[model samples]
Target: MELALVLPIFAIVLFALVEFTLLFYARADVVEASRIGARLATMPGITQQNVEAEVKKILPPQLGQGAVIKTEMGKHSGDVVMVAVSIPMTLASPNLLWPVGYNLKGQNLYSETRMIKE
Candidate 1:
């Protein structure tokens, strides 16, 4: 009887831990994608369109669809180039014990980078 009572809670905690790990991985990927985009923007003659295309290519398929890329080019030489990437996160459903589903769902993961134009 005690085992049965504890199993549900244990399972829910495990599920939540796994879900959070996945979320962290996704967040890191998004940040890396943004950094890549910013680096590409720093290259000579690289347009915003090119940067966006490259960022999408670098991001995973699921994130690519929902990803938003924003680029800001420096007005003058030796200035800074900025790239921002945002991905919407949908949490795993049927969360039995934790409120993570409500807290994480529909939230956006974002990353931004700035580098000097080269």
Candidate 2:
């Protein structure tokens, strides 16, 4: 009886662990994309479109076009250029923990990177 009772709980925990692992991995990718975008933004004469393209390229394939990328350039040469990226996370599989209200879908993961203009 104990085996039957604990098996489902273990299975749910395993699924939840896998789901969170994928989400964290995706989050790391988003952070790297923002850093790359910020690096690109630091260069002079780079338009918003160019930065966005590079950022989208850096982002994981799962993100698709739902990502929002914003770039801001300061007036002076030595000023900061910031790149902000936001992506909505979708778990790899069905949320097994949803029965307990542990849904993690559709949550926006945001990353901002700032670099000084060259």
Report clash pairs, candidate 2.
none
Per-residue error at 101 for model 2, in Å?
1.0
Q: Can you write out model 2's per-residue Cα lDDT over 1-118, one digit (the tens) per residue?
A: 9999999889888988887887788888889999999998888888889999999998766674778888897667999999999887652334567777887577787899999998
- What are the clash counts of all predictions, listed in order? 0, 0
Error of 1 at 16 (Å): 1.2
Q: List per-candidate RMSD values in Å.
A: 2.5, 1.7
Please give the CA lDDT of all the candidate structures: 0.82, 0.83
* Per-model TM-score on C-alpha atoms: 0.86, 0.89
Q: How do the residues 28-118 of candidate 1 rate in per-residue lDDT, one tens digit apiece?
A: 8889999999998888888889999999999888778888899998766688999999887663222333454445556788899999998
Residue range with the least summed lDDT across 10 consecutive positions in model 2: 88-97
